[model samples]
Target: MSQSLLIFAKILSPITSYLNPNTKPPTIAKRYKGKATLKLDIPQGVADLLLKGVINTDTRTYECIVEIIGDEDGSQSDTAKLVVLVAPSTPVCKIAGVAEYGQNINLTCLSEEGTPSPAYKWQSHDVNNVPRPNPPKTTDKNGILSLYNISKDTSGFYICTSTNEIRSAKCFIILAVMQPPMNKVSTCVILAAVAAVIIFGIIIFFYCCRKKNKPEEYEMGRSDEAGGKQLFCCHGIISSSRCAVTPTNNV
Candidate 1:
């Protein structure tokens, strides 16, 4: 008994397609060459479509039909689904909005390819690359990390990870949060003026001390709360498939 086979690629979306069954090996369609082939065992009454190196695009519903050569009305058909799972690819990192003090900014990370639409995570580090906590009102959703009223403390590095059940990939960017230009310029000028005055005073003191044959040195140091750049802690959101850092007393 000889067998004839018919195949169609269709799924929930209903794409009309047909695969030729009139060749010695049961020819696959042109677009399916190399990607698809047929396996037939006449004696065993079996015919199957073999797919190779399937990708995300290959995920769909397929239908197969089998007919006995002499029995025009005797045909069997079956439908099946193919689902492809892919790991997240390396994400592209970006910064939206200005990273200026007291201004809103968003850090966005995107994975160009993934099967299940990867989730995202954002982590912050200090200038020293040491892990740091996010500010009071940081919000991360879908791949957008929103920081409100960024300050100098927000100046550092940020890493974004894209993840799925299959695997994960990551990308990073530097965030140098700055004061507004006008404010920054004014601050610089003021600091310079203060330094000059301090220097002039030191010169006068050294001159007077030199005349008296006495030597003394002055040292200046500065410390700020944000300058400490300590790592922050987090209250993780488990249900949302987000990655969160643990909180520490240092926060």
Candidate 2:
């Protein structure tokens, strides 16, 4: 009849462990004649083998093996799969083109590093920090928001939220749709028009004054006894007042 002995081994070290020949050997004597003994000062439970931390470049799994030399059961081993959890980071946002009326633009959000790839959600708000009644037309996909032929109504604050199973993060940007400048009447043109009108008025006023101050001429009829003579005078009418000078002519 063969005797069977059960040996229990507890791995109590940092990340990795291995047997050292110079300090201690892991093999048992073939004939069971030699005494094989292991002293464990600090008892550590198996649950402590499962390592957990934030996911980064140095995350990996570790394995522990328990071996018995004379046991009917061969070598027995167990592996601990270490998994690191990472929360979502603040999303980076970018605008593709100028925010102007009648122009097409795109807003993009990105969460570069996360344990689980993050999803994106887009929202808009007005200048007063209130949600708009009717949001602009957009295509929400992956992490991009597209606006076609944007208008003044599309100008506002855009919020981009990135979410994962672990956590969520958000970022915001302002979309300002610029309006084309209005055409204004020039001051130079107005002043030129006013000056032209004044010059025309002055010309008309001088013409009227010249016509009013010019001298007047009159022709007077002579009596029959004066042998049918005609008279011309200046500065007075023939019948009203005496003339300063008179010119007589025969009919």
Candidate 3:
């Protein structure tokens, strides 16, 4: 009596085998016998088919059949499916439309490669550093977050998380709502006015200090027939006169 085995890759490509009765040695298909990764256990009726060193792209179903030669019954067969899971990669996030106040915007998040296509969740941190779900916005199944009538209060740090059955990943971006150009100009003008006031105050302080340190002056009176003179010293407009001694003894 003799027996044979057949293994199919996805039920399409077949690998045939022959079992010799007297030698107890099984012969495998020539095409698959030389493969280093392929292994066969004839006695146990097991075959390990190695697709390749890398399994990223080799996920599919496989089937196998075992039969006894000259038997009235048909061959026994089984099938199995293969699945490869990959963790979610770093997600990419983008904001569509202007981020100004009172405008609509869309935040898109995507993870290009993952096993069991990844789903997304959005989180945000406000100016107060509190974490919560993004408000005034709606997220869809495709991972798009829509913000309607945005405002300064809506600006903060946003995080996009991508997750699947395998694993999860996240990416973040900062949302800054800017004031109008005219408002910025107004702020600049206000700052400039404040600086001018400070400079004027410094100038007035120095002027007052110089005036306080000025030297006092005295006024000299005309000489009289007696050949004596009087001096008037003015201290901030309050003056007093002091008379000089008459010179008559020398004469």
Best by lDDT: 1
Worst 10 residues of 2 by lDDT: 42-51
Better of 1 and 2 by TM-score: 1
- The best-first sequence of candidates by lDDT reads 1, 3, 2
**Across residues 1-251, which tens digit of lDDT does each residue of candidate 1 receive?**
34454544454332222323444455556777787766665557566677899999887778766555667787777898888999999999999998888899899999999988999999999999999887788998999999998889888999999999999999999999876789778999999999999999999999877756634322333333675633332231123222343444655
- Tens digits of per-residue lDDT, candidate 3, 12-55, equal 86544444343543444565554324457667767666654435
TM-score of 3: 0.57
List candidate 3 stretches off by more than 4 Å: 11-36, 50-52, 67-73, 179-251
Minimal lDDT window, size 10, model 1 = 233-242
The sequence of per-residue lDDT tens digits that candidate 2 reaches over residues 94-137 is: 99987877888899999877666788998889877788543556
Could you tell me the lDDT of residue 115 within candidate 2? 67
Candidate 1 lDDT for residue 237: 18
Deviation in Å, model 1, residue 211 alpha carbon: 63
TM-score of each: 0.60, 0.48, 0.57
lDDT of each: 0.75, 0.64, 0.71
List runs of model 1 lying over 4 Å from the truth: 1-5, 11-23, 42-45, 67-76, 183-251
Ranking by TM-score: 1, 3, 2
